[model samples]
Target: MNSPQTINGLMRHLRNDCKIQISGSYQKQQLTSYGYYHGYKGYRFAGNSYRQIPYSDFSEVVAVIEYDNNLKAALYPELMFIETALKNIVCNESVKGLKLGTFEHLYKERMSDNTTNTKLQSKRLKLRNSVYAKLAARYHDEEEKENQMVRHFYNRGEDAPIWVVFEILYLSDLAGFFECLNEAVRENILKQMNMFDISIDANKNLLSIMIYTLKALRNSVAHNNIIFDTRFKDRKISPVLKKWVEKETGIQNITLYSLIDYIIIVCCLLKRVDFSGTRALTLLNKYKEENQRLQNSVASEIYDHIIQNNVPAKVVGLEAYLNV
Candidate 1:
């Protein structure tokens, strides 16, 4: 039902239908670089099928896409670090507290909580089984023989240690595993991560929520999803931690919908875990650098307009982290 156009035809349609002003060769070069589908079509702001707010210039769309690409590049490494660090902390603490490495032990001692809600218990058991199945498959795979941990566990015939099993678990699985933990075990991991001020119950709940959020973020970054304009589905941060972020960032109305707020959350967790957060700082600096570069370009006003009207307000606090 849809007709295809050449790149130049697409450019003409953008000029005529979208009312975008294509200035010169530079804008055309950008269109060539980013492609028409992603560079132009993706950035359209439409309220309905018939009504659309045209980008003032082609450069505006290019700037937005470039900023998003830069952000994704900068965030990928830091997010990976945070994911690994959180997994390691959870597995180490859970092993010590629960006093077992095997999947059966974890399921029986920690995951098999006596819940009043049968549906909730059933959901958790489903997650547990899924994790077990994945780990078991990975454990027996011939390709995984080179993995020292996998080999060690396979030879032992006992279910793998927390560390070994973690070698195969996705970040989402790790977060789900944390949720399945007994309150005491979860609280121990939280305390170990330096969340001492909060009560054990609050810490357990907060960590569960934060990890879930981080898992979502990690998946997005890992899978090369657009980072800048993403509004998270589960945007609620725990009240106590929300207050802490408000204090730390000096941003009064912090919401997880903003990518900047998510970065701040990652920085907060890194600080709690004593990571120094150098990668987060690098990301903030990179953002500032990109913003500065845009300011010096011919597209400065367009860039400013896009940022002011479209980008998240929490992005303003990115500069503060440079001094930190």
Candidate 2:
């Protein structure tokens, strides 16, 4: 193990070991506030520690850190809105087919994939058990941590409504429920959302897949993980999904490897789900301004790596798409 070092020691390490020009009380204050481990260690590398980013100054690193913080601030509330909207949609559809919206009823009538293939059926059964296990553990005892709403349902010895049930699940767990839901319910959920890809009679499962895919970014933003490099992106962007985005927005290559790509995804979803008629544009403009702010704060090369040149064009394409 290595010896523990003070913030100043970390600063010296940055200057000597990392070959970055970091000095002065202002930079020292930044290192102290953001931390040598979390902020600098995170920003110094591109995707991994081995591949160091071409940062010549501590200010550039600070710029990236600040940009990431701002990006998370900008994206998180919209993410929450989208997640809640999805939950409501799923709940509505799950209940529509049943007189009683009990979890069991939803499980049988709506949640199961109803496949005949043995392997798929086995996987479904295991997943069903997992969901039951998770819910059972959460609702097990009358602890103070449990909410009144949950306690009310539990006290009655009645299963919680599918809506309440979904409210408690993590986004990924919610994705599981969505993935297993009957095709019609999934299609209807997407239809109700007015989702661009799913409602068009194509990519019905895209909604769930999107929930699963975007969950990584959601988790990162929620937890204050690094966003400037987009290393938090967990899954490969599907070509089908990319093509849908590209075809719809007229953006040529939807790599989803840049921060702007996520903005595009959010904008696409927002355009459909946002009722105010101005929220998506507001977000887009905010993103453009933020990117420009980053550009002004850092070297052009650093800004290019962070924001990508295609971002401006993509933003234009997205705005045009939203206007349509």
Candidate 3:
């Protein structure tokens, strides 16, 4: 008889591991078959299921170990990716009349690609001076009324073409994601306010800065690049700006497992031009629910695990922007 190291010795190994005691009288009695817990017995391969057969029929025996580890290795990582991408889509598409209002556009373009998107890219001043003029005309007394107009104009809806909505959301600020996030950062980081109190330029340079930052984050995820441990190579922001980059870009540093969360923040901020600083968590929840079936079937448990560990709070601190 071959030793245990031989592939054919697996049956002998299994027999030794069994708790059932076999008497000497039963050992020589023709052994037919054996079964184990959890469908290990009668496992079929190549038209073979454990059945009573003569020893001559046992040409070869191979053992395969199957067990459930339940580690869910990619749960958080995949969730992070999905969350970030969806965030960008929802936020960017919420803006009204943005030229490149499609998730595909946001996914494809980089900061360098910003220069090529002429009509796709425009300063908020230009938008306010033109289509969103009512936003600029309002004062403290009628703040609520003016905010309603902005929401009506920019809210993402199925009525409009998907691309148009995406452009609006991506190009818009992320202030709508969280009210506290709004209060934490500079109001004019993107320089939406007009400079020199003259013609509507609205800090064209600042809008350009925002454009490039979003482009970098968008491209990184679209290309399956690493997010948590990333050092963006082609970033255009200065060292001082890097500290507040997430704030300026409207990225709430929560559990940045995916790029979608950041994108949603940007979309909500852009809607702020006309919105009353409403949060997008409700919408985010809806999106997650819609995809729950697939998530569950794929055995992805990151979202649930995150809630259990409360690890997301430690990953990104939106409150830090308040200090910056």
Candidate 4:
């Protein structure tokens, strides 16, 4: 078992074993403030923890830590807004458009009942079962006592409404439901999301695909996980989705490789939610200033690993779109 060490001991280990030059009058205080596990270990790599970042000095670690802290501060509110907006939009659209608000109605009427396509039918059955399991757990598990929604439904002796179900679902769960929705319903939701267009109408899955792509960053930022290197990106981004962003913003090579691409996604979503382009522009400029701050604080190579060359073009293109 590894022995626990004090801050001084950790600094010694970094110096002697890790060979990192960590020396400053205030570094110990900084270490104390952020802690060894979250501040240093969290910043020790780029993209993956196994791939150790080339940190020649302690200041670089400090730079990364500060950048992450500032990023979370900047993004937390925005994430919350996007999450609530998406849920509200989806729930309202589904209930009003379909003229059905109950879970069972939506599930039975909206889901595929085709016996000819066994695979799709089976897939949909599984999705239905998954939702049932989640609902059962929520109502019967310890959540019944602790969760107000569960308790409310528990007391009523009535099935939880679809809106109530939507309230409890995580963004990932919401994405699953969206993906399984009937094409017309899904496309209508996409139109309400302001993501409606010919390509989306053609490849209707793009809406849910986008939600899945955004899920990682949303969950990570909400949990205060590292994002500067976009290490939280855990899923495959479809080429069609990338092309859509490129077409919308007139920016080429819309790789979700850096943090700025995330901002672009958020900006697009914000636009969909009736937020002015000015608000997104504010976020972009804040990100730009944060980049400059980190650049001034960290080594160039480390900064380059997190922010790529195409980022400036992405920023400019997005800025132009917002300005328009």
Candidate 5:
């Protein structure tokens, strides 16, 4: 374990060891306010591995941190809304023919068919068992005693309803649950959620893609991870949705793999769910405002680096879309 250091010691390390030029007390004040580990170290990763930064300036690092903070603030509410909407829709559709809280319902109707690929079946069973184990722990634990829904079910000698259990599930857990369901059931849920214009096959494919993408975005936003330049490696974009985004933004190369594409996808989802999308629009505007200073600063190179690695057209198109 490394020895702990005070703020003054950290400031010295930044100036001497890191060779970063500090601008008097203001930078120190920021260090004190946001902490060296979270504020400095988090933004430091944006720099090259050699710890060399543009102009060797500490202010650029501060600018990057502020930009990320604004992004997190702008994204959290919209992502939360999307997560809640998906959970409610999926839970309602999944519990149709069975009692609310029984594992049998999931095994019979929701779990993947065992007759299919043996490896896939084993994987699904593992995921399902993990989820049930988590649920069981929560049910038995007093940690959730104050949760009114849990209390209500416990008092009545009944298991919590599907919706209630869903309340405890993380967005990633919800995505796994969606994946474990039969394709037809997934399509039915999507259709009920106002995705009916597409063919059943297309809808199934789109839902799988969206669930995977949204799960990545939701985890990033919820965990205060950097959102502006995220490129989801595991998510596969639906070609139909990609085409729609390209058409809407008039950007031919909108790949739906970066943060900008994710935002556009969320907007599309909001429209499908009969939401006005005002919050999403507001978030875009906020991001635009917060991002401008960094775009003009040395940190712009960092953004450019991420763009080079991902899709530059989508990143630039998102700014254009927000301005419009």
Candidate 6:
């Protein structure tokens, strides 16, 4: 017979302790706590006054581990990469494609040379107007100010390409992730696809598969969707992937992760593109200060828990991909 048990104060300790070693060997210790307000029938593991259902409900605990790792693992890397890329993109003067003279009027002589006020202001206005107009049209009863602005701009309008929009939102972060890896890994990826094969059809097919893979991962992260264990959001087949696998691995229907893995391999083969290693840590610190400076209750709580626990940081650096 199994006795019912409940866990109340376990979360605090689990978070503060970086690692837990049990027995003679050590494994990554992750604490998953579930609270049932009214305890129900079950068996539970008791430690340090905290109770955990022993997971006897399943044949194994692998499923639970997979679920946790996938969502958190995939998301953190994707998020961290994207954040770093955006920062780099914004800070990198070359990418902005602007001349130093353009910013001279905005700040004092020394400061003015590096300013981005004009472009940033334009971007801010465009975003604000676009958002305000859409909302006003949908909810406001009276004639909206947006109508006047639209008439002023005339009939022509250009919407930025969806892909470009996604990139702009998180450019520096993505760049940082892509930049950090070694070149050998990337060449291995290209080699894996047999891009140098004698047949033109084979080369084309490999290229197509590579493009599709990057695009899919791009879409998932750009849209703020869950990454680890993501159901391929777009199932459009890549003939290149199908053909190459059929010829080489004798398989079809490769996964989205497989494709991104290929891109990562390619990135690694290029000359090393390490960011100032401090960027990630810097961002986390900035986030903490901003939350405190603003006195944002929720942000402060998240900052304390996430930074103190390092859950998000660990997830971003998924150890599995370390050597790759």
Q: Pick the candidate with the highest TM-score.
A: 2
Q: Quantify all predictions' global Cα lDDT against the true fold.
A: 0.67, 0.78, 0.32, 0.79, 0.67, 0.33
Expressed as tens digits, the lDDT of each residue in 84-176 for candidate 4 is 888887777667655556778888777654447776677677777877787777777655265567557657887777888887788887787
For model 3, state the Cα shift of residue 254 in Å. Answer: 8.4
Q: Write the per-residue lDDT of candidate 1 for residues 1-324, one digit (tens) a residue.
A: 888886677778878877888746676777888888765666554212243333677766766677767777877877777778888888777767566677778778776555776865876887778877887677567464565666565677755666767778877777777877777777787777766445324546567667777776777667765566453334566676677667666766656655666777887676655456466566766776776665565354555443444234555664464356
Encode model 6's per-residue lDDT on 214-239: one tens digit a residue. Answer: 45555555564433233344564455
Q: Each candidate's TM vs. the true structure?
A: 0.80, 0.91, 0.26, 0.89, 0.77, 0.28
Once superposed on the true structure, which residue ranges of model 5 sit more than 4 Å away at CA? 1-6, 16-19, 45-55, 97-103, 110-114, 117-120, 193-205, 231-251, 254-258, 296-324
RMSD (CA, Å), each prediction: 3.9, 2.3, 18.9, 2.6, 4.2, 17.5
Candidate with maximal lDDT: 4
Q: Model 4 TM-score?
A: 0.89
Candidate 2 residue pairs in clash (backbone atoms < 3 Å): none
Q: Per-residue lDDT for 1-324 in model 2, tens only?
A: 989998889888989988889999999998999998898877877665676677889988888888788889888989998888778777777788487878887777775565776755675576678767767676664466746656678779887777668767789877877777777787777767765464443647777777887898899999999976778888888766777777778888887678778788888788777778787888788887788888888888777656666778888888888889
Give candidate 2 regions above 4 Å deviation: 48-51, 196-203
Q: What lDDT does model 3 reach?
A: 0.32
Model 5 residue 180 distance off true place after TM-score fit, in angstroms: 2.4
- Tell me the lDDT of model 2 at 50: 73
73 Cα displacement, candidate 3 (Å):
26
Among residues 3 or more apart in sequence or in different chains, the pairs in candidate 1 whose N, CA or C atoms overlap within 3 Å are none
Candidate 5 local Cα displacement, residue 195, angstroms: 4.8
For model 5, residues 18-89, the per-residue Cα lDDT tens digits are 887775688889888888777777667532346433437777777777777777777788777887888888
The TM-score obtained by model 5 is 0.77
